[model samples]
Each structure stands twice: as C-alpha cells, then as structure tokens.
Target chain A: MKKLWWKDKFNIFMAAIAYLTLLFIIAAIGTVIMKGFPHIGKSLATPEIQFAVKLSLYTSLISTVLCIVIAIPVAFVLARVDIPFKSLFNTLLDLPLALPPVVSGVCLLLFFGTTAFGAWLEEIGLPFVFTIKGIIIAQIFVNLPFMIRVMKSTILSVSPRLEFIARTLGCTPTQAFWKITLPLSRNGIIAGTVITWARALGEFGAALMLAGATRFRTETLPISLFLNMSTGDLEEAMAAANLLIIISIISLYIFNKLGGDFIGGTRGV
Target chain B: MIKLADVSITLGDFSLKNVHLEIRKGEFFTILGPTGTGKTVILELIAGLYRPDAGKVLINGADSENIPPEKREIGFVYQDYALFPHLNVYKNIAFGPRLRKMPPSAIKENVQGLADMLEITHLLARFPGTLSGGEQQRVSLARALIMKPKILLMDEPLSALDPNTKRMLCGELKRVHEKYRCTVVHVTHDFNEAAMLADRIGVILKGKVKQVGVPREVFERPRDQEVKNFLGVEPLKAVYAR
Candidate 1:
C-alpha cells in the first residue's frame, strides 16, 4: 500500500493529539464515576442531603429564570442598539467570567455586607448576605455572562430585516420582539438557560462565601463537601463530591444535546 | 403616493446624496442600478428602516420620519426573501393581519386568498426552510401582498431564484400588482427585469438617480456613457474597431 508523504507525519501527529485529548477526558470522567456513584443513592435519600439538593435545584432554577429575564434586554441592547460606551458594557458583562469565583464572592460580600448599599437593602427587607437569597444572587452574578453571550450571538445571527418585516406587517416594536425575535431565537434561549442552570448548579466558591456553610440552612452541595472535608470525614466529603460530579455529568450531557439542537436549528434557518 | 425629496444617507462607505424620486399610486416603479449603488437604501428609507441624514420621506403626502416601519403601512420583500423561518407559509402570510389584530376569520380568509392567488396553497403547511427557493419567494411575496400596503417595496426579490422561476414570478408579480393596484418600488440590478416590470425606471449609479424615464426612453435613447453602459449598449463592431 502506498501512502502520501504529507499524510505520514501530519496524520499520525493529529491522531495522537486527538487520542490523548479523548483519553484525558475519559480518565477524568472515570475517576468521578468511580468515587461518586456509590454514595449518591444513600445521600440523595437522606433528609439533610435531600434538603440541600432540593434547595440547590430550586435556587438555581429561579436564578436561571431571573438571569434570562434580565439578560435578554441587556443582550438585545448590546447586540442591536447603539448605546454609549458599548465596549464598556460588553467588558463588564464578561468580567465575571474572567474573575475567580472566590474573588467574585468576596466582591459580592463587600458590596452587600454592611456597606451603605447593603444597609439600604437591609432597611428595605432585601439583605443579600448570609441568606438563601444571597446564594441566588451569587449564582445570578456568575451565570449572567453566559446567558448574555448566548443571547447576544443569537440575536446577532438573526437578520434585522425580519424584525423590519414584522414592523412593516404592523407589529409594534415590542410585538415584533415578542412574536418574531423571541420565537426565532427560542433554541438559543433554551440552550443559554440550560448552560446557565448547569453553571448555577455547580456554583461552589461564591455560594460558600456569600451564603456560608450552615447545615440545613444555606448549605448547598459544594458547601456540604467543604464542611465534610474540614471535619475530616473523608467518606462524607467524597460522597458529596461524587454526588455533585454525577449531577454535573447529567446536566452537561443535557446541555450539550440541547445546545447542539439550538445551534443546528438556527444555522439551518 | 410615496415621495422622497432630496433623501441623503451615508451607510458606511456608500452614500446616497440628495436623491429625489416619487412613485404615484397604482404605478410599478423600478430602481435599476448596479450592486452597491444604494438602491435598497432608497426602499429602506421609504419603509422607515433608515432615517435619512437629510431630506424627507413622504407617504401619502405626510412626512414619515417619525413613523416606525410597522406603522408605515408599507410591505417590504427583501432580496433574500427574509421569511420567518420558524413560521409556516399560512402563519407567515397571516402575520401582518394578526399583528393588526384582525379577527381570526378575516386573517384566515385573507391568508387563503393570497395563498390561492400565489398558487402556494399546498405549501402553506410547510416552514420556509422546507420550501424550495421559488416557493420561499412566492410565500414572501404573498406575505407582503396580503397586508394590502399602500406601497409595496421589493429589493431584488427574484434574484435568489433560478432564471426560469424569476421569469415566471415576474408575470405573477405583475398580475398581483394589477389586482392590488398598489404603488410599487422595486430595486433590481437586472436591466431586463427593470424593463419588463417597471412603468418608469430610475437609473441609479453610485447612489444618485442618474436619470428617470420610461424603459424604452432610458434603454433606447442613452443620455450618458454610464447609462449607456448600464443598459448594455455595446457599440457596433465597426464603431468599436474604429
């Protein structure tokens, strides 16, 4: 069999890189699976673990919803409107993504802990420190950039002509957005939501700093794992870590599938 | 009943400087130009998509600068047929009326009427993505026409179709224009299309209306070198050799 000279070295190198990447990913996944699954069933069934799981799910869902509601308008403005200092707004939106989660937690704590703004918030019965609400705020702050980026691209991908057509068809600007822009961008919206929800679900450092690791109160899964590790209970810590790993895997799988659907559907359009 | 008075626009590098033109009610007017001549900008200006940097756009004798595109009561068909890909043909056609909050029965009747007129009744259940290029164009035209807009603006609507489909749709468009009796501003780079479809042709070169006249007048009698070349006026072989 004759082989082309160009294919000989380059092909083998590319194949080796691909195989190594695949092997690394498989190894990471296998380790998580091996350590996490056995503890998941019992922990998930226990009342304390169940409450933490339930709270995590509930808060993340709410935070995801809130992020979407806030992000869509901001994304639209960023994508379509000629706002002042657009680059600044874009940079600010992406800042959280670049910042370490622990730093973000600290920043949130300073902004909302006993400061003038925090005092005002407290007076209004809306304090955001060491509360369940603080967890949601942290998740929202971290997840907002992901949603905004997704929505901005989605909105950008759609031709402005379609909206113009809608308006010419007698839809008010709001109506055009609701009927045309929203429906056309449904896939991107869902994909963004899933990814944002997953990010919120796995949120650890910010939740730890802002909400604190109070058992059965503000203790999310990551906090539970941290508390277990600090207490020198390796089995419980490993169990909690394993449970989180399982959830992350399941959520990631769904996100990948849905994200593909969103991207593929829009491309065909 | 659409008039533009000294409309000037600067869209990045291409600029329309002091452009003036008018389309009377029930007339099929075409803007014939080369690519990047800002012909579509004229239609968009009239449709209120872009506010002119200078001058006025009048719809039915009213200054329409403040009017939104949706409120302009004009229907536009883009070059790519910009149909809502998520919507089926029936819904796409019904969009305008539904936005207007016309009764469901009226919307259905109007959609069916336009669908029947365009011979796209069978494809009404299919999404725009599933439709052929010709089918998508027809559906786009139907969607625009069903609104019964005061003026219909089409920007190279048939450019995406096959030549045969283009020819066929041209006839259909003429018939539709006749039935509706609406003023039309059609932008196309194809001289043949302009000649076939225009009641009056406005020749735009580099964003300015170089000349405006009937098809025969613009084509047969070349006023300038640019207009002559645009009309494909090849000098006789002997004259060229000379």
Candidate 2:
C-alpha cells in the first residue's frame, strides 16, 4: 500500500470521532447497568418504587392516546388547509418543544393553579395541581407538539389530488378524509405513537414541578430517580436509571422493526 | 348542457381572463391548447373544484356557483389516474357505490359488470401500484363511470400513456362516451386527439378561447398567427415512388 496522505488521515480522524461518541455512550450505559442490574430485583419490590413504575406507565399511555386522537386532525389542517396566521399558530404549537420543561410547568402552574380558570376548574372538582391528573396533563403538554410534527409531515406526503378526486366520487370533505387521507397515513401514525409514548415515559421537570415529589402519590420514573437521589438512596436511584435505559432500548428496537419513516411520518401514497 | 360566461379566476401568478364556452348536451367538446396556458383550470372550473372569481357557470339552466364538488355529481379523471394505492382494483371501482351505501350484492354486480366491459376483470384483485399505466387509467374510468355522472370532465386523461397505449385508450374513451351518452369536456394539447374525438373544438391561448367551431373550420381557416403556430402542421409529400 502507498503512504497514507493527509486527506486519508483526516478522514480516519473523522471516523475516530464518530466511534469516540459511540464508545462514550456505550460506556455510560454499561456503568449504569453494572451498578444497578443486580439491585433491580430488590428495588422493584419496594412499594413506592412499584407505584412510581405504575404511574409512569399509566400516565404515558393515556397521554399517547390523547396525542394521537388530537394530532390527526391538527396535522391535517396544518398540512392541507390554508388558515390565516398558520405560521404563527405553528410557532406557538412548537413552543413546548423548544422551551425548558420547568418553564412550561411554571406556565401551567400560573394558569391552572392561581388564575380565574384554575378557580373555575377547582370549583368543578377537576383540579390539575399537585395531583395525578396534573402529571398526565404535563406529559401531554410536553409531547403533543412532537406527535403533531411527525404526523404533519406524513400528511403532507399524501397527495391533495387524491382528496380532490374523492370529492367528485360523492364523498364529502370529512368522508374523503376518513376514507383516503387517514388510511394512507397509517405508518406515520404508528411512528408518532411510539415516539410519543417513549418521550412521555421519560418526562421529568414538568412532572416534578407540577405534580410535586410526593411518594406513592405522583412519582413517575424520572421523578422517582430525582427523589431517590435527593435522599442519598443509591440503590433506588440506580434502579430508576436502569429501568429508563432499558425502556429506551426497547422503544428503539420497536422503531427498528417498523423500518423507515418511524420519526417523521414521511411515507407517501 | 354546460356553460361558462365571462369566467375569470386569479390564482397566484396565473389568471384565466374572461373565458367563455358553451358545451351542449351529449356533445364531446375538446379544449385544445399549448402547455402552461391554464387548460386544466377550465375543466376544474366546470367540475366545481375551482370557483370563478367573476362569472356564472350554468349547468342545464341552473346556477352552479353555490354547489360543492360532492354535490355537483361530475366525474374528474386526472392525467395520472389518481387511483387509491391502498385499495385493490375491485374496491377502487366500488368506492363511489360504497359511499352511496349500496348493498354488497349490487356493488359486486356493478363492479364486475364494468370490469368485464373495460377488459379489466382479471386485474381486479391487484392493487393499483402493481398495475401498468393503461390498466390504472381503465380502472379510473370504471370508478368514475360507475357513479353514472351526467357531466364528465377529463384533464389530459391520455397524456401520461405511451404512444401505442394513448391511441388505444383514445378509442376506448370514445366507446365509453357513447355508452354513457354524457356531456364530455376534454382538455388536451394533441391536435390529432382533438380532431379524432371532438365534435367541436376550442383553441385556448393565454387564458382566452381564441376560436371555437368545427375542427375542419378551425384548422383550414386559421383564426390568427398564434392559433396557426399552436397547430404547427406540415404537409407530407411523396418524393420517391415505390
């Protein structure tokens, strides 16, 4: 072989940089598993830890379902209809994705904890402050924008020409959407659902602020980890971190099984 | 019968300015034009897909402005056929009838009868993505015709096919029209296709109809230089005798 030139050496350096990041991630995850995997059995048997796991699953599942039900119509409107101030509305919708989770939680608190609307909601016996309902609301708030982003791209991939043709076939606008647009968006919807569920499961700062760190009451996985770390309980903290990592891996595996367009709903008809 | 009187629409950079036409009942009227001249917009206007900015569209002595496309009862055949990819050919043809809540037995009868007539009975089980261009067009026809639309609008329906398929489908189109006996408003750029199929032809240039009459009259007696340029005809002479 000829002598390696500077360009070839630089390319090798780039590959090494990629491998370095990959290695860093693997080592970090390895540390977590090595420290926590053995204690997982005992930690999970704790009543508070069991409640945290149940609450995380329960809230994320409900939020994922609500996100999908709301995202379909919202994405269709953004993709197809020409609403005035659409760009402004879109920016507002995407605000949750850009802002810190704590700031969003603060905003939610100001609206639902102290304002007239909060008073009205409390009067109706439907409160969302320092309760399990507050945790579900926080999860939905954090993940709905992402679900809509994925779903909107998927809807955009479907041709408006198909809907135009359906109109001439004696179907109303709503009927056309039901028959044509929704079916073509099946892959995108599945992808959005998976990603939303994963993100909701890992929700932290908003839940911590809004739902409070009450044990056996509103503790989700991330909140459980935070509360356990605060009290210097290494075993419980490690257990929480390991469980989250395993869940993230499972979510990624399901995405791999689904093949392409798992994140953006970009499949076309 | 259908008519567009002083119809105008401004969409972004292109505009149809004061266009007019009168398509009689059961007549095959073809609007011939060059590309990018808004030929498709006229067909869409009549189909109620696009509303005119400042004119009246009368359908059989009724003002059709307030009617939406679903209520217009006009069938549109896109250039690319616009078949639903998820549904197989059988369900695609049965879609309109299903929307009407027709019984399964009647839907099967109509779908199978139309499929046999279109020579696509064997392809019913296949999805649209697997079929060739000609087959997709034929299925599109069966789908639209099953609704029994009284006014059919076609926008370059044969433009996407190969030359041989185009010629064959042109014949099939005429046969379908005769069997249906509906008013047809076909927009195309091919002079041969218009001459072969149209009872009367309209020449559109720069968003206006320059001439509308019999094909022989419009061809032999050119309206102006623009119309002649659009025709782009040349005489063939035999130089060598065999």
Candidate 3:
C-alpha cells in the first residue's frame, strides 16, 4: 500500500471543498427547474410574458451594437496613444463598473429628470425617462465599461510594429488600422460583443430604476420576473425565472467558451 | 540620396544628439553600432517614421518634414520580420499595389515577380504564422521590395536568423541590392556584415557617429580611444613589442 503524504491530504481536502460547492450549485439550479418546468409552457402562452421576452431581445441587441460602435475607437485611443490624464480617464471610465447598477440608474434618472439639459433633450424629440429608450440607455451606460475594458486589452496585444510595416506598404494610418489592427483583433471583437450582449440581456436593477417596472411598456425579462413575484403570482413568476435561468446558463456557457478565463480579454488576440 | 543635417532628438530615457550623415544615390551604406546605440532609430528617422527635434531630414534634397510615411516612397524592413499574420504571402506582397489601384493583371504580375525573385512563390498561399524564420525573412523582403521604393532601409534584418541562415541571407541581401540598385541603408551590429556589404560604413557610439569611412579604413584605424577600445582590435606590431 502507498503512504499518503501531507500534500496528498491537503489536495484531498481542497478537492472535497470544490466538489461540495459544485454539488450545492447543481441542487439550487435543479430545484429551480423542477419548480418551474411545468408552468413554462403556460407562461409562454400569455401575452405579457411574450412581450417581456421580445422587449428584452430587441433592447439588448440595439445596445450591444451601439456599445461596439462606440467602444472600438475609444478603446483604440486609450490603448495606443499617450493622452493627457490617461490614468485618471481610465479610472473615470471604470467607475460605472465599480459602482452598483442601482447607483448608475439613480444618477441617470436625476440627470434626465430634474435638469434643464434633460428638458432640452426632450424638446429635441428625444425623451429617455421611463421609456423603452431609457432601458437601452441604462443598458449602454452599465455595460460600456466592461466592453471597453476588454477591447483595450485586446488592442494592446497586437504589436504596433505591424501597423508601421503597413504604412510602408502604402497604407495610411486609417487604412492600416482597417487592414492590420482590425483584422488581428477579430477574436477580441467577438469576445467583447458576446460579453456585452449577455450583460445587456440580463440588466435588472438599473432598468427597473430608470425604465420603471410598468407592465407591457418598459417590461424586460427581469422586470417581468420581479412584477410577477411581488404580485404573488408564483406560477407566472416561476416560469419567468426559469426562462431567465436557462438564458443565463446558455450565455455563461458561451462566454466561458469564447471569452478568456479572466476579464483581461483573450490571450494571443 | 538621403541626408540628416545636424539631427537631434530626445525621447524618454533615450537621446540621439548632433548626428550628421549622408548617403549617396544607389550606394549601399551600413550603420554599425553595438546594441541600443539608436542605429534602428536612425533608420526609422530616414524612413520618415520619426521627426528630429533639431534638424531636417533631407530626401533627394527636399526637406522631409511634410512627408508622411505612406507618401515618402520609402521601404523599411524591420528586424522582427513583421509580416501580417492575417495576410498570406501573395496578399502581403500585393498590399501596396492594390492600394495604388493598379489593375489586377499588373498587381498579379508584380506579386508573382517579387515572389519569384525572393523564391517565395511556393509559399504565397500560406499565412505568415506558418512560415519558418528564414522563410518569413524572405517574405518580408518580398513585401517591402514589391513597393519598389527608391530608398530601402533595413534594421538588423539578419539578427533574428540562425547562424547558417544569417550567412546565406547576408549574401542574398547584397545580390538583391545589386539587382534592384535601390539606395540601401542597412543597420547591424556585426562588423563582418559592414565589411562584406557596405560601400561605406558609419560607426555610431554614445549617440554620435564617431567615424564614417570605408570598412578597411575604419577597421584599420579607429577614430579615438573609445572607438579603438570598442572595435576591440589592438593596433600593435608583434615583432616590435617583443
């Protein structure tokens, strides 16, 4: 018989702890499915739950596209150039990520509700307070920092020497970016897009604060779940919660497959 | 013709001060220096990649202050062979001509010609990541030469290759310069490279061009004590010493 060493005992203890955590996770998710599986079909037949699903998909798609369009150049500038107050600017960009989603929602609500600037925006035919557009705005505001953070690291992994070589091949700076840097950053763009879309799809507290919990109007999936649970409609709430759980599981699986293990963007991108 | 008239630049911890040099048309000139002596910086400056804080970079007797790198009509080969990993060898060589909006037939002809010349025609379909170090070196040469720039600047192009590959590429480099007859400015730390390829050599030390002469002259008689010590060949008569 082989003798067990101290390291062997330590390894077994750690492995046991990890397995326990995994077991608890499986139990929690399994119970949610068992409670809600039968009512999901009934919930889907209802118009209110259907509206929530459609609204969530529509708003998240738009916000993800907007974030990508805005994040690329901002990330490029942050990663490539030596701008004034770069560290300070980076910290300011990250503040949204560090703060709670509710705080960002409150900040947005006050700025767009009480100020003359908000009134001016309203006069110009763009109103954001408690509207569907407000949901999209909150999503963008919440997820832009994560998208930019991923993109900046992605841009850093590509060497500037490739762009310099492109210039020698008759490419202007803009042309070089399109031909060289952008092509090299295809994986990073995909990773950034996937993570942003997932976050936007599930944004809850900020959407509730900024877009309001109005049924059939600003009702997203999480909002639908919140409203049904609060009104003591356990069957409808369970169905909505189950739908969210399935989506969350799928998105997380995709993110783990496509994105890096950590938030520092993909390696060798 | 290229000339740097009393050029000086200071960036962060590195500085190049009071550097003056001239290269005649169609001449193969080599700038020889030890590591981190800013030899590559000089090549980049000549290629319009950098601007001197104090003096003008004159290309064909015109001040290069307004010339961006794209419009400078200069080709640069980097030490690391920075071929675009996303582009195959054919597209890599054809990049410049396509940008010029040359007709497809002409672009194909040009790409094939340079690839054939560099002996990389077989690797045209393969991306840069698949190529060996020597193969990448040849592909990079083809990529730059495809532009047909009047001035070709190389920065330690052979440093990354193995010893055997370096010797072979060094001979090919001379042959390519002769065939193209473009004004060549090659930077390297090896004394043997300058001795073999340069019509004239500039020895840079401590951010200055300490001596500019034919290889024989510079090798036989170094400028000062620092250069004499740096070249590492004692000027002594063995019989007299005995």
Please give the DockQ score of every candidate, comma-separated.
0.83, 0.81, 0.76
Which residue pairs does candidate 3 place in steric collision?
Answer: none
Q: What is the lDDT of residue A241 in candidate 1?
A: 75
Give the Å shift of residue B41 in candidate 2: 1.5
Can you tell me the CAPRI class of model 3? medium
2 versus 3: better lDDT goes to: 2
Question: Could you give candidate 3's per-residue lDDT for residues B1-242 as a string of tens digits?
Answer: 89999999887789899999999999999999999888998998987778999998999999998898998888888888998888888888888889999999999998888888778889999999999999999988988888888999999998888989988998899889989999999999887777778889899997899999987788788989888878778543321222
Please provide, for model 1 over A1-269, each residue's C-alpha lDDT reduced to its tens digit, 9 standing for 90 to 100: 88774578888888899999999998987885677667667666767677777888988999999999999999899989998999998998899988999899999999999599898998899978999999999999888987888888888878888998898998888998998888878878877787788778889888778888898899777777787789876666676777777666676666566555445432211
Clashing pairs in 1: A167-B70
Question: How many clashes does the backbone of model 2 have?
Answer: 0
Task: Give candidate 2 regions above 4 Å deviation.
Answer: A1-7, A253-269, B235-242
Evaluate candidate 1 and give its CAPRI docking class based on DockQ.
Answer: high
Name the runs in model 3 displaced over 4 angstroms: A1-7, A261-269, B234-242
| Interface RMSD of predicted model 2 | 0.7
**2 or 3, greater by DockQ:** 2
User: Candidate 2 has which clashing residue pairs, if any?
Assistant: none
lDDT of 1 by residue, B73-177 (tens): 788998888999888889999888887789999999988888888899999899888988899989989899888888899999889889999889998988988
Q: Poorest 10 consecutive residues of model 2 chain B by lDDT?
A: B233-242
- Which 10 consecutive residues of model 1 chain A have the lowest summed lDDT? A260-269
Off by over 4 Å in 1: A1-10, A260-269, B234-242
Question: Deviation in angstroms for A136 in model 1?
Answer: 1.1
